[model samples]
Target: MEPIIHGILLAFGLILPLGVQNIFVFTQGVTQSNFIKALPAAITAAICDTLLIVLAILGLSLIVLQFDWLRIILVVAGILFLVYMGKVIWTSPAANNKETVALSMKKQILFALSVSLLNPHALLDTIGVIGTSAVKYSRQDQLLFTYACIVVSWFWFFGLATFGAVLKKVTIPQGVFLLFNKSSAVFIWGTAIYLLIGLWQGAY
Candidate 1:
């Protein structure tokens, strides 16, 4: 019981921080008005995270942890990916339109996967935090820990999506939309830089 409590607390602690995922979800809520669209993105991210968790349990992530060069490579790639996303978001038009809606599903899924899989931060969370923490528990406890992590993912995704969809109906100026996009760009790029710094520090 105490393990479960700790697992839940850890999940909340890890996710409550500001990151690309949170920013994207908030922006989606502001623009799409339908939080359901964010569901796919959230689920995709959760699935990727679950996979990492499982891998960590199997000791695969230990291999990753041991390889400094691999971490460096992933961090660099993640930074590049975030930069590209930031550029696209910065250039994107603010108005809600059919074209945007049509592309939303694809874009959301892709972004979720990219953020989950490519981001060094996600790797750190899974490998460093969750994985290391799970070692103290028995196999059953580890399973429970993994489940708690999934619950965290599900709760955050659903909650954010629902919140965002609700906000979609609120009247806002066009400039606000533009500002949101630009702000998201800043967030994405900033996170990427932070990940790069972590990688550099680890490498050296």
Candidate 2:
């Protein structure tokens, strides 16, 4: 019971931070014509998290992520990708957005996977936090903890998507979505710059 509760709390703590993955899910929710249309993003993000959590707990990180150079590579790749995405978002014309339809499931899944899998912080959280925490538990307790964590990921995504959907009542969704894209661009660029500075300072 304690382990279950601990897992939930840990997951919440790790995921509550504003990051690329969370923002992706939230933006999908806001831009999608309906909450149902946002499911692909939520599901894909959750699936990526599930894979990370399982592999982290199974000690794959110890085997494959032992090299500092590998971590650096991931950091560099993530930064480059984020910077490009930020520019795309910031430069997208708002006038064309009103006619935009909900994202196809394929695009949603791909985008979700990109943000969820590529984020260096998410990888660290999986290995450093979830993996470490699971090591202290018995096999049965580990299963319970893992399940709780997975559930939290799914719930959080849906909750975020729901919040986005709710905004439809307050104003024009296309305008709100365009505004969100700009905000998301700022966030992505800020994160990229922070990562670059951190790497320069050997903060990683």
Best by TM-score: 2
Using Cα atoms with residue i matched to residue i, what is each candidate's TM-score against the true structure?
0.61, 0.63
| Minimal lDDT window, size 10, model 2 | 93-102
Clashes of each: 1, 0
CA-lDDT, candidates in order:
0.64, 0.73
Q: Candidate 2: what lDDT?
A: 0.73
Q: After the best TM-score superposition of candidate 1, give how far the Cα of residue 159 lies from its true spot, in angstroms.
A: 1.0
- Candidate 2 lDDT by residue in tens digits, 50-158: 9999999877345434666765665676577667766876776542222234688999999888899888878977876566555545678878989999999889888
> What's the C-alpha lDDT at position 91 in model 1?
86
Cα displacement (angstroms), candidate 2, residue 96, comes to 21
TM value for model 1: 0.61
